[model samples]
Target: MKKIFLLPLISSLLLFNCTPKETLDETFQKINSEVLANSKAYATLGEATSTIGHRLTGSENGAKAEEYTYDLLKSYGLDVKYFPFEVETWMRGDVEVQIGNLNKRNYEVYSAVSLAHSPVSADVDLEIVDMGNGLEADYAAKPGAVEGKIALVYIGILPGSPEGTSNLHRSEKTALATDNGAKGIIIINQVDGGVLLTGTASVTGGLIDIPAVCIGKEDGLALKEILKKSKKRAKITMTNTSDQIKARNVIATIKGSELSDEKIIVGGHLDSWDLATGAIDNGIGSFAVLDMARTFKALNLKPKRTIEFIMFMGEEQGLLGSRAYVDAALKDGSIDNIKYVMNQDMSGNPRGFNAGGQKGADGFFDKVGEHIKAIDSVAFTNQNSNSAGLHSDHQSFMIQGVPYTSPNSNLDRSIYGCYHSDCDDFDLVNEEHIRNNVRFSSMMLYALADTDTLPARKLNDAETKAFLEGNGLKLKLKIGGDWRWED
Candidate 1:
């Protein structure tokens, strides 16, 4: 009689203690509320910018930043590791540039920065040759004019350029000048009022034989005017250093209960150009990713597939960390397990998502957008796009036929003027903008991980080639020495 009474009591307790599982909508609502109330992204970014400064790869600051993010990930109660790889990285050194009539001794000294991967040392004084637009056709238009001279090229396509005229990257422009026997190259910044920009000018990620540097827009324009009146000469002097060093990519994993074989990667480049604090360029994206991981652990929500939050190093030098990761994965035959990649590079305030050339994935993303819209209709417009771009960590995975996506963002106009410039500091970042990236992206990632069937699959080699060609990226890839398919 006592045993029978205990059985009834046990059943009553079990029924009273069990709680219903949360629906997807309720989970999303919870994520929205939790992030708005106690978001850590802004504070973390403020601390990083104030304390760490520039996180240039292969430098002391770079290592500190790597460890900083690594420690934070560990603190979140997630499985984290360092993906170490060796690379020959470049760092800036002393540089000097002077422009005027060198023969007349009336030259004016101007401030300049050497482009990455420039030769270790260079001292050149040559007459300036104007190479408009810096395309192959421009060289053909004035045959042998730029030989043995310093080539002056515009960093952007000039206004009213002929229809269908394609602009080349600074590295490609450098290659064109070198192939034409130019002694040196000077790239004109497109921005006005003395704004300057710096980035790699080597296509192969190796130091070029010639010196390459950039000058402010106002200075370049003044030089161009002087050329119009009479001939002028440029003297470029630079000293850079390159060495073999080991850098690590930080990765934090959240394991799924079921369907753990399929994985989703959300990555951003942590390495920044050593100009300023890099608070705007990638600080917004990377720190937001960190907060997203924290949000996941705080809520302890387990989806169907695993998710990995990655902070890639050496991207500014040439996508070094990402390329290393992809190469190793391919060699070990683990590439097949990766289902998708979502990249954030200088991304902020995402109003929608980009499908990135994934066929049959539009409907899936659109449905996901509706859910995100429900969470914050004003911030997330649900305006989805489809395209593929290069010069980021995503390219490493996309080249291997992995489907990729990124946030479709419309940042403040003032922010873009600071890209790769010294003004890319903490002042430009807005808290609300980055918070949207964290909260909405987390929801989208959760959906992708938990879905029963993914709408897109890995593309074969031929399909990959076709996709690139259809998107008009074949020429750029070929110019950058990343084109794998034969003509």
Candidate 2:
């Protein structure tokens, strides 16, 4: 961290009588130095991945991971507790697919996997229909032809969209295809090479009516080319087990010196896909929260407002743990104590912080980013994004008029190929990335909690609705059937 000194800026530190600006600077430095020197995030993440394996919610491993995290937090001497929640959990089964040649000879279906939460035990020899991007117009083109055929489409927008074309999400694509009459759906992975990725196919996180699967980039292109030349068919057989299971949210609190009732929640989901160890997807984020809490205890640092370090389970299964947390908070009237939530979900290696609040929080985030850069210019710059995104624990907070933040970085693209695949193990994670996240985000959490003049606060229901509309999240909410606002 290079401390750029200006003549007038030196006067700024001394201007504050109680908590001087220098003290804040020193705190940031202390956090960085401690994290860079003795960060337990990597080691703990190693243990989690190696020992506990994948924490797929509803599975035994998921239960073990929950208890493991609970015990770990208790060992940290923090006030820790577990909030249990039930969710419909799905498991992967023997999924096999074969493509038929023009002569009807079955061939291998290379680099393919059934999409998560697909219907269990489906056996179908459905004819394949290439639907391009599987947009609404594409489905409209086929009309009745898709009623019994398997719809093939790109997992992303094909050849990029034209000007003013709004691309729907993959799940949305699946929903459209099924609703239009497709018996099955096959999405081509945008990622090149043979890396197979698995994510939810159902927008609501429940089992989709039809089986959906993802094919690797190379295979999908070859399949598409063959389909274009001659009529081909596919046979898919899959067996999956799903049941409602118990999950937990591990939570611990760092008591505030003042305004203890005002709370700031920092969390990431602990449960990840069963495909791999889930190191990068969330172990990085959740462990960052753990180490940050450790660093605070190690340095005996306490902020002015309470900080709850939470590890939510069942996020990949539709944010179940976070939803339960929010429900409990609302039921017990504890929701009012929450001032902000910083969700570090797959948002490691921070170039800056993203205030994904319901309303505009750029000015506040910009100030926070400046301070972070003054301490560690490499870790953070003037980058601040104000928007809301789904498929993370933060969404549970964002829809309820609460303010939220996530680490902003370009590093996300580098890992999309392995995000939910078997490649998402401990090896893909960078030590420095975890350390930097622990350092920078911990400072952000502390700053948000301590800053007496912070502009972010809980929004009213009307303001929340408007904020969602302003952020262009209304459509997404409506697509997921999460929109509560009624005209």
Candidate 3:
């Protein structure tokens, strides 16, 4: 009698244990279907790029962008918050450069937009002096040649350039010229037959105290001719301002039941240059992630781990919002709970998703790449071994030893032509491409979150140190001796 009762009880327990709660594959399918079905990608992207317009870092538009993104996420039923941070603000006021002495014909020239954290400037003129490729030898040959004259350096290095070439030729040329008493700088375009492209300055704050401008090849040539003919020299005058500006990061969380503490982050930046709307630069990424979150909630597919969608401000300003987030999370130990981060930036171009990350995460990226290929002929390249970090907001987490990946396209000769210019508008984005990227990234996140075992954190101390040393990073070593920390 005792044996029969115990056997039956054991059988009942086995039956209860055998019933499955939910499989990873099932959750992925549900989530993927919802993402595809409720794809409002285009409309959302249009509103983000056109309606709210350019969200320059630390500007009123930047703050408004934070509000817009937070409200959108909150409306989608996710727990939302604004992560406010301080950034040195800079703004572009009226800027003008004119050329008239060449053949005595006046030609209008474009002026550089003030990059975040750049100093204010007043109308001033500096003698224009051409520094060939701005190389050290060129500077040495003409020591004091740039003295008291604004150095007109070419945009990129020459083909037969020297080794250990400092990537700061353009910046250094300005600094050196300024230190030697030059009033400003004019960077010439390196394009063979293309117009010059002006961009905002780097967001690193300082008081080097000089105005810099980028001019087109045509304008540069015109100025060159003027310098050659005029008894005096070519001149430029600019006015700008720098002040304390406010910005914020938009955060939204979709809670899970089984593992609420662990998180998977997705999304992109909301800021852009004031030239044209930043449709292709990052509007697509923001919209796709927003749609993904909305779809998941509408389908009521509760993930095993929480999904956090962040729309960062000041990415164009050197990833200020994301960096602030990482610093805070690392200081407070909140980064410990993060499983991984999948950053979607500039995903709407004709090209497919290209994956890159730390070395140990190669296998994970390979699997994702294979999956993307199976869905569509989306090309994927593994950049794990090279350790090319800090190109985007993803770097913020990777610096803190977080396993993260960014789905970006390769920057071949063809791709750079349209990036970060007035041409990066809605027409530049391919709908099919954006859809495919969204599908791939969403599936990857769902698969990772629902998996029984997390992908092992494989970046040991040796690998981490080698990476940091090679990349010129000064990192604080952890006591565990398995990872590095950022001081």
Candidate 4:
């Protein structure tokens, strides 16, 4: 009888110990179900927008936003920390722009706003030289045309430009104008119906000697027509403020249970252009990241590699916040431990992921995409891309040879017209779309964190230079003074 009892107890113990561990597929499914059922991304963003409004770095609203995210992450029971940094930031002030013919007393006042980093005080009246497209080739076409005068350039490439012409950023155009000896610049907004846009005009993030401002598309075109009839002079008078300020970047860490030494960073800029609420500009991206952290904690996930969810500030004025973080990482020698970085700036409705020119990452993401597709075949089509671009937080890491990727966004075309404009409000966001960002991106983040080994490794100096050149970003980097390689 004793032997039979002992045999039955041994069989029960063996059965209890044989329970299977959860697979990645099962975890992904759970993530999808949990997000679909209970996601606070949309609601949290709504609260922040309705209450805090635009989160411009170094502003009161910006500080509030920082604290808000910090508290939320703390509520999620994650290891949260604030990395503070000092930066000289620029703010908009009073401005006035007028246009009239040369040698005329009266001028036609046009609706315009001063671009960020404009002169602290400026009063200039000069002839408006229309340099088409504002490319170096355009400057070559018209020698000494924009010298000591006001330059008028289109915000986008003209319709009849060369077939392979690449457009420059507004800041780059301003830089070209300054380098060509222009006294001031008048950028024509591309949007129709008198919509003016404002962003940073100085590439160096320092106060520019000449004033720069933007005018409505209709007004600009009408001014162009008048100039065709006769020469016109533009008067840009503005007063901006530049001061030193302190800003903080919020980082929430989910420590890995197994491979704690390896790290994956998922970050988005919490700061936005102060034209409007910045709801679509980054509300979708940053808030989605916040909720992803919440989801990971709620599910009690412990990936093999640690993940750091960061909300970066000072992105609109420049990449100040992310640059600070990367600098700190480099100083501490923990930069090598960072294996991957995923940035989501203005990202929504993820159709696929971009490999960011990282070698061997395409196959890795493709395999992971299948699991995402299993969750929602229609929304997540698993079509990945291998493109890379600049003017985002990822550039800070990409330059350091850390591999990066982002969701291939499919935002509405209409909404894009409001970029850096006043129309980027909470109304532009769709609930299901932002939810999709959280679901799909969180899955990708987990896959990178929990995988046995990452396919992409940190590139050395030569390999990084080759990657940038191949992606055609070398010229842009040189233009922005970010090129580290010798020409």
Candidate 5:
């Protein structure tokens, strides 16, 4: 009699458990259809690049881009909001360099560019000291030799790093150079054919109290050869203008139908370098986010958990916008509500998604990836991966013990010469690429939000520290002076 009574209850429980997955699978179909049929990601990217140009953090073009994105999100009639923050604006001025004796003060004028946040005027006259790769050990090897001299380092890691070794950020290299009392820093660009790259050498947004500049590979090598025969001295004259200005982050909210407290963040930064239109660097990723918001509104698709579509600013200047967002949320105790984060920086043509956490996230990502592939085997077959990398907005969320996601894209490497250069224009963008990203990413977002029980959980303070150490980042963090845990 007891077994007979329990049979009906067991069947009811099974039906209840399977119902949400069925609903989620069906909803995923609708989202993919809506995005594929009518996704304006490429068109909107074209418009944004043509109209506002490169959206620098504190420039007039930056303000225009902010307004454009804000108005576009406002059109959806969702709960759109703008979070503004102050950033120190950095801009370039006349830059000049020459090498040789003071009689002529002229050896050759190779193409050189100024790094951001350098001193207002650098009229330094000093001898050059080549520090290979600018690794920490290089500074330690020659104590008291770099003071009052220009330290020259390669912008990219040389071709000789061991298999298990990782290179530090360019700014971190700069920090090491500055700590050793170097009067200035000269970074050599890896791109051939006289391509000069300009980026912030200061790890933090603040100034480094030294002049930083980048020269081409050919020119840098020529200088090194000249140093071999005799002492090589040079003169550098540069002026960088800066001011404090307000920047904005645009956010659009779609409330959950059932579980209102649980939230997910879909984020991308809108700021880019002032050299070109930045069409591929960020416009594709961020405009795709904007199009996703439009698609959700057009289709009236409501999931079980809330979604926040965010456009950050000041990413080119060291992730100031995303850091501000995370700090505010933590201060107000709203960080507990967030369950997942999807960061789309420089993303294009999604082949799959990256599960950015420990091994526990693998099972959940495999289920979702397989289900999507089943819908369209030709497109999403064998595309997803369970991997992670640092140096994007995802780092802000990951450090807070949140699981994150990013597009596993197959980008072309030939055009890397255009990155941070004046050639990252609209010509590099593809129509099909942006559309594909929108369709696939929209499907993934909906599925994540609609699933009944998410597989990931937030780490406690101790657990978060353990995760960072386990990932083998403690040494890198210690070198960069970001280590918070004591021995």
Candidate 6:
């Protein structure tokens, strides 16, 4: 009898130990099923994109968008708050440029939205110097020689043989020119028919203290011809203003049950370019994350860790809101408790999504990919760039050594026709894409929040190399060699 009683007690202990694990899996399945049942959650993305519209940094529209996001999160019964930060405001005014001695007619040119905190300059006549491609060699050839002269630069296409890759180099050239005492800049777009493309000029550190504009390819060719014919200069006039302004980040938190101290953050920017209502660039991203938060609450599922939703302001103006949040969190030690951050910046495209993160985050990404693949809606590709370490809000947390990931579609020459342009609008978004992104994001958060064991934290070179090779990624590893630890 004693032996039988001991056997029964041992079996009961074993069952008790496995109960939480079984429950976790059951809860995940339930959440996934609910997501499938309510595919219209993506419609909220459309509504947010259409209703809030374009949200330029520091504009009234930006503020309105933030409030709307806050209210949306609050309506889901989450604790919502605002994190305010100070930023310099730059308002775009009328910009006009004319060619001299040729057609002599004022051609329509688009102003590159001036960086916030740049100095204002009125109409001025200045010499134009063709700095070929504005590379380091070009700048070294004539450093500081551009004082009081307008710099004419060819905004060369981004340097991959493939078309439409993001042009980080072009923005770098603009920054270098502004830093080297160029009074103003005129960039010639390399598009067909010399159509002028207008975009916001983002300066990271502070305001770019100079004026800049982009002209049509035809205008650029015309100017080159005029210079070739005779020693001619163009008279350009720009009116602008810059001042300190208030920026805020909208944050909402869904509290968890057992391990509420650990947190998972999900977000996208609440700002857009002033040109069109930034319906697709981020309005969709914002709505998808918000809808995820709502779904979590509606299901009445209790997570093991907290989930925080943020709608950042000033992303268009160089990720100011995210940067500020990270800086403040670091100063206040708020980041110490964060497990991971997932950002959804642009989810309107129907193509599959791209996943990237710190070198050691492969395990976390694999789990996310598995959850996404289970839904059969979105596929994940790994690119080992710092999801949180680069230009987006994720970068803010990356600076604090936190891990993060973003799910965005690839934009090689084949598919990146609408990023940051006037063309990024609501009609461009696919409902299936948005639904898949939201569903996957919810699953990822649920998995992280419910699991008791953390994913593997360190990655070896062999593992890293295999992961990158398998994913067809060509990333330049930037972390120091000593940072990798032997598993």
Model 2 per-residue lDDT tens digits across residues 424-450: 999888888888889889888888988
* Per-residue lDDT of model 4, residues 194-313, tens digit only: 878988898777887789999999898778778888998988888888999889999999999888989999999999888899998898999999999999999999999999999999
Rank the candidate models, highest lDDT first. Answer: 4, 1, 2, 5, 6, 3
Task: Looking at model 4, report the run of 10 residues with the lowest lDDT sum.
Answer: 15-24
Q: Candidate 6: minimum summed lDDT over ten consecutive residues — where? A: 476-485
Off by over 4 Å in 5: 1-22, 101-104, 137-145, 159-166, 478-487
Best of the two (2, 5) by lDDT: 2
Tens digits of lDDT, candidate 5, 247-303? 998899999988878898898888888878888778888998998888888888788
The TM-score that candidate 3 achieves is: 0.81
lDDT of 6 by residue, 287-314 (tens): 7788787778878867788888888888
Q: Give the winner by lDDT.
A: 4
TM-score of every candidate: 0.94, 0.92, 0.81, 0.94, 0.89, 0.77
Cα RMSD (Å) between model 6 and the true structure? 6.9
In order, the Cα lDDT scores of the candidates are 0.89, 0.84, 0.64, 0.91, 0.80, 0.64
Superior candidate under lDDT, 1 versus 6:
1
Residue 465, candidate 2: C-alpha displacement in angstroms: 1.0
Model 3 weakest lDDT span, ten residues long: 474-483
TM-score of candidate 2 relative to the true fold:
0.92
**What is candidate 4's local distance difference test score?**
0.91
Candidate 5 residue pairs in clash (backbone atoms < 3 Å):
none
lDDT of 1 by residue, 324-397 (tens): 99999999988888899989988888989998877677778889889899888999999998888899999999
* Candidate 2, position 277, lDDT: 92
